[model samples]
Target: MTLATAAHAPEGGTTAPAVRIRDLTVVYKTPAGELPAVSEIDMDLPAGTITGLVGESGSGKSTLALSLLNAVQPPGRISSGTVEIDGLGDVVPLQGDKLRRVRGGQIGYVFQAAQNSLNPLKTVGKQLLDLGRSHDVDDLRALVSEAKELLGRMGLDGARVLDSYQHELSGGMRQRVGIMLALVLNAHVVVLDEPTTALDMITQANILEIIRNIHAERGLTTLVITHDIGVVAEVADQLAVMYGGRIVERGPVRSVLGEPRHPYTQGLIRAIPRLTGDIDQARALPGRPPTLGTIPERGCVFRDRCELRMSVCDTVEPVLERHADQLVACHAVAGQEPDGGAPTDDGQEQT
Candidate 1:
C-alpha cells in the first residue's frame, strides 16, 4: 500500500480525486429525533497538499473524516451528498463493497490515538507484513525489511520495534507507526484526525514535518482535522472553520487564519494562548457553541455566542456567500445585516 505501488494502481481509466465531496450531510438518527452532525459541507482536496479542518470538539470535524470512509460509527449515517474518487470512479451515495474499496485502496486514516488503535497481541512487523500481503505485494522479505527502515526513519528500531507490541512502544513511536501504515500503502490521500494531539510539541513538530515531506515527495493529498491554530499554521494550504455542523469560513489558510472574516473565527484566534499575551491575560470567547443534538431550527446557530449577532439572526439561516476570496456563512458577514441597523463589533451603529 506504499506510494510507489499507488502510482501503478489499475488506472480504472478515470482521473484521481484524492477526495472530492459536495453537499455532504451526516445526521445521527437519534431515538428522540435526529442530530445533524455535518450539514451541507462542500470540500475539494486535490493531490499533493493538505487542507486543514479546524473547530472545537463538537464542531463535527471528525464526522467529516469518517464520512469519507463511510465509517460513520453508528447512530450516524451520511444523509446525502456525493463522494467521488478521481482515478477509479465516482462513488456518490457509495455503499457496500464500493465504499470499502474506496477506503483502504485510495484513502487511509491515521487515527487520533495510535496507542489504542494498534493491535495489542500482534507484533508491529507482523501487522505491516500482513497488510502488504493482503494488497498482493510480492516482496515479503523486502517489505518486512522496509518496515524496519521506515521505523528507523521515524527514529525507532526497524527490526526490534517490529517484534514489539503497541503497548510496548512509547506514545510517539506508536503514532509514528500509525502514520507509516497510512502512507506505506501509498494511499492516495491520508485523513489525519488529530494524529499529533497525543504527542509533545517537539514530537508533534517532527510528525507534521514528516507528513509535509511525504506529501511533497509522494504527491499525496492530506486532510488534517484539528483545532490547534498552530498546527494549521504549519501545514495547511486551505482552512475550513466549522461550527454547528456547518463550515462558517473557509479559504486560503493564510486568509482564514490571518484576516478571519467571521466573528467566530476571529474569536477562536483571539482565544489562543499566545506567548506574547500578558502572562495572565489570555483571551477567551464569551459563550459556548450549539449542541448538535438539539440545535435551534432557525437563525444562526452561533447567535447566542456571536458578538455580532443581530435581531435578524433569530430567524434567518444564513447561506454560504462569497466575500473577497472566502466563503462565509453568516448573515452579518455576508452583509445582509438585520434592521439595516445591526450592531457592529464595537456595538455601535454603522455610519
Candidate 2:
C-alpha cells in the first residue's frame, strides 16, 4: 500500500486540534551539563486523527511522548516548551493534582512494551480497580463495566482476561489490555509508544487494525511513536520524522513518503526492503546515529552520515522550511530544489 493511502482520517482536516506541541525541548542533567534528549520540536495531533512520529532508537521519540503528559522524570525535565491540550491549556506549568488529573483523565498513554509495563504481581482486574480508585471514580461497578466493554470490543473475554495476571496473557492480549486501560478512563487524546514492538508480522498487522478501528470509532486524536516506518505508513494520516532529537521532516503521510526531501528520511525509506523491488536496491545508511553526548552542539546532527552533506551543514543547523507539500530541514535539499524534487529509482531525490 502507498504511504498516503492508509486507512486514516482525512488529510489537512481537523476540528480544533486535540494537542499542540510548541518549541518542546526535554533535557537530561548529565555531567556534560543539560544535554537535550528532545530538541525544539513542534507538532500537532489533530482532533480525531493519527500522527505518527518515526525514528530510530535514541531519537527522542519516547522523550517527546512523555512531554505530552509532562511526565519526564527527574534529571530529565521539559526544559522549554508548551504542550497544549484541548480542554487543558499549556500543560508545561501544571503541577500536582492538576497534572495528575490530566494524565489518564483527559489523555491516555499506551507505553512501549505493553506486556512489560503491566504488573506481574497483580491481576489485570485488580490493577484496573487501582486505576479507577486513583482517579476517584465514584461508581466502581460502572468503571468495571466500561473496562469489560472495551476488552470485549477488542474480541477478548473481558472477565477471563481481567482475572488473569500479566504473565497469563499473550503479548497481543496484553497490548489490547494496555489500549483498554488508556481508553477506560474516557481519555480523548491517546499516545501509543511502539504499540507493536515485539509482535510478529501478523500480530503487528492485527494491532494496527485495532488501533485504526478504535481511533476512528471513538473519534480520538492519536500520536503513535515507532522506529518502524512501515508502522507509520499503516495507520498515520500525518507523519513526522525525528533524528538526533530534532524533527527533520513532517507532512501528510502520502506526500512525505512519496517524495522525501531530507537525506535522513530518504535514507530511511531506502533501507526498507520491498517485496517487489530488487533486493540489492535496499541498502543501509552509512553511519550510526549520534548519541546524547556525541550530538553536535552546532551544525546539522545528521551531517556525519549524510551523503549530501555540504560545508554549510558543518556550521549552521538547517531549519524546517516548506518544500512543496512537506516541511524539510536540510541545507542540501533547501539549496537544490524549492519543490523538494521527486525521488528517483534509487530513492534519492532527483537533483
Candidate 3:
C-alpha cells in the first residue's frame, strides 16, 4: 500500500496507540559526566502500521528501540519521558508484574542477530512454542501445531526444524525462527532492529516482504530500526529521522524521502543507491555523527557535518516545529518556507 494510504488515523479508533512515546531520553551517568544516547524523541506508533526509525550507527536508533522493550543495553537508562503501550499505558515508570505482562504480551521484538536471541541448547520448536503456551496454548500438541504453522509461513521447514537445535540451522534460518518466536506472542506491536542486516540483498528483500505482509494481515503496529533507506521506503508508513541523540525529522515517508527538511535527512536521501538513473544526483553529507558521551554542550549536534552550518548553530539548540504534515528541527529550514513544507526541486509546492 502507498504511504499516504497506510498512515491513516482511524475514525474514532478504539485502540489507544500501540505505543505512544514522548520526549523519551535514554542516558547514562559516566565519570566524564551525564551522557545521552537517545534524546528527545517523540512519536505515536499507531496500531497495525510500520514506523521506520532511520539513522547511522551510534546515532542512538538501537538505544531508542530497546528502551521501548525496557531492554536497553548496559550503562544506559531512560532519564525522562513516558512509554505508553496500547492497552498498558506508561511503561517506563511501571515496575514488576504489570511491566512484565505489558512487555512480553503486548510487544514482540526481533533482533538483528536472530541467532543470538535463541538458545543453542534447545530445539527451535521449544523456543517458538514458549510464547503461545503462556497465553493460548493448552497442551503440547496445540503449541506444536502453532509453531509448525509459524515456521512454514516464514519459508522454513517447520516440521523438520522443529526437532533441530540452533547449531543445526543456517544464519538466515535462525533469524526466521526468531521472527516466528515473536509472532507466537500475538503481540500488538513488533519491534524489528535491522532484522535483515545479516542477510544478503535477496534475503533482505524477502524478509522485508514477509514483515510487510505480516503487518497488513495482523494490523500489527511495527517499529523498524534500520540503517537502510531502501528498507524504510519499502515498509514504512511513517518516518522518524535521528541524529546524534535526537529526532530531527518526522513525517509521512513520501515527504521525508522525497524532500527532506533537515540537513541530515537530506544527506541520508542522497546516500541511498538509485536504480533509476538519479544515483549521481543524490547528495551525501560528509563526516560522521558525533559520539554520545563527552560531547560538546554548545551548538547543534550536526553543525560540524552540516553543509548549511551557520555561526548561530554553534550557540543554539533547534526545536521541532510543525510544517504542514511533517515536524522538523533545524535553524536553516525554519521560517524560510513559511508554509512549513519542503520545497520541491522544480519550484512546486505541496501542503
Candidate 4:
C-alpha cells in the first residue's frame, strides 16, 4: 500500500481515527534520576488497519502500547504527551474509575506472554465473568455468550476451553484465549504485544493468520508490537521502527521493507535470515541495545552502531524528515533526494 493509503485511510474512504499519539514521553524513576523509556513520539493508528511497532526489548514499544490505556504503573509515568482515542479525548489525564472503564471497554490489550497473564487460580469462564462484573455488563449471560462465540471463531471448543485452566491449554491455545478475551468486550481498538513470542514457527504462522483474519473481520484498529521484523512485514500495513526510545523510521510496510532508509532499519533487515540468500550474508547487529540508564543524553541514539556515522551525528539529533514515502531520522539520510542521491555541498545531487 502507498503511504497515503496505509496511513490516512485504508482501501475505503476516510474514517475517524482510532488513536493519535503526540509528543509522548514515558519515564521511570531511578536512583540516578528519571530516565526516558519512550521519548517524544508521534504515531497514528487509522480506524481500520494494523500498525506495527518494531523494536528490541528496551525500545519502549510496550510502554507506548500501555500508554494507550493509561495503564503505566508506579515509578514509571507518562511524563508528557497525549494519547487521544477517537471517542475519548486525551487519556493522559484520565484516572480512577474513568480510566478503568476506557481500558477493555473501548481498547483491548493482548499482553506479551499470554500464558502468564492468565490467572491460574481461576478458570477461564470465571475470569471472563469477573471481567464482565468489573465492567458492569448488565447482560452477563449475553457477555458469556459473546465470549463463547469469539473463542469458537478462533477454532477452540469454547465450552471445554473456558472450563479448563491455563495449564490445560497449549501455548497457541492460550494465545487465542487471550485474543478472545481482548475482543469479547467488543473493543474497537486492539493492541497485541509480542503476540507470538514463544510459539513454534508453525504455531506463530497460525496465530498471525488468525490475527489478520480477526482484525479485518472486526474492522478494528490494531497496534502490534514485536521484535521480529518478519511479523510486522507479515501482518502490518504500516510499520514503525523504534530504537533507544525514539522512532527511527516509519512508512508504509512495503516501502519501508523494500527500501529501508534509516541505518538502524537497514541493519535490522540485513540481520534477518533469508531462505535463499547466501548464509554468510546474514549478519547480526554489533553491540547490545542500550539500557535505560545508559542511553545517550543527546545526539543520535543509534550513532554508536551506525556505519555511516558523521560528525553531525555526534552533536545534532536528526528529526524524522520526509524522504519520499518514508520518514527517517538519520543525519546521513537527511538531505538525500527522493530518488536516493545525497546532495553535494554545491547543491547538486551527488553521482
User: Lowest-scoring 10 consecutive residues by lDDT in candidate 2?
Assistant: 342-351
Clashing pairs in 4: none
lDDT of 1 by residue, 1-351 (tens): 122224322333123355667788899887778778898777766555578999999989999988877788888988898666667555656778667656666788988853477878999888888778767778878777766766787777778888899888887888888877776766777899997897898989988887776666666778899988899889887788999898888777787887887888998998887678585565688877777755778888788888788998999987655554566778887664343332243231121
Tell me the whole-model lDDT of each prediction, alpha carbons only. Answer: 0.76, 0.86, 0.77, 0.86
| Model 3 lDDT on a 0 to 1 scale | 0.77
Q: Select the stronger candidate by lDDT from 1 and 4.
A: 4
C-alpha TM-scores of all predictions:
0.87, 0.91, 0.88, 0.93
Sort order, TM-score high to low: 4, 2, 3, 1
- What is the overall TM-score of model 1 with all chains considered together? 0.87
Best by TM-score: 4
Model 4 per-residue lDDT tens digits across residues 195-299: 999899998999999999888877788999999898998999889999999999988889899999998999999999889969889899998898899889889
* Stretches > 4 Å off in candidate 3: 1-17, 129-137, 276-283, 341-351
Candidate 2 segments whose C-alpha is farther than 4 A from its true place: 1-17, 339-351
CA RMSD for every model?
Answer: 7.4, 5.4, 4.8, 4.5
Task: Write the candidate numbers in order of decreasing lDDT.
Answer: 2, 4, 3, 1
Q: Give me the overall lDDT of model 4.
A: 0.86
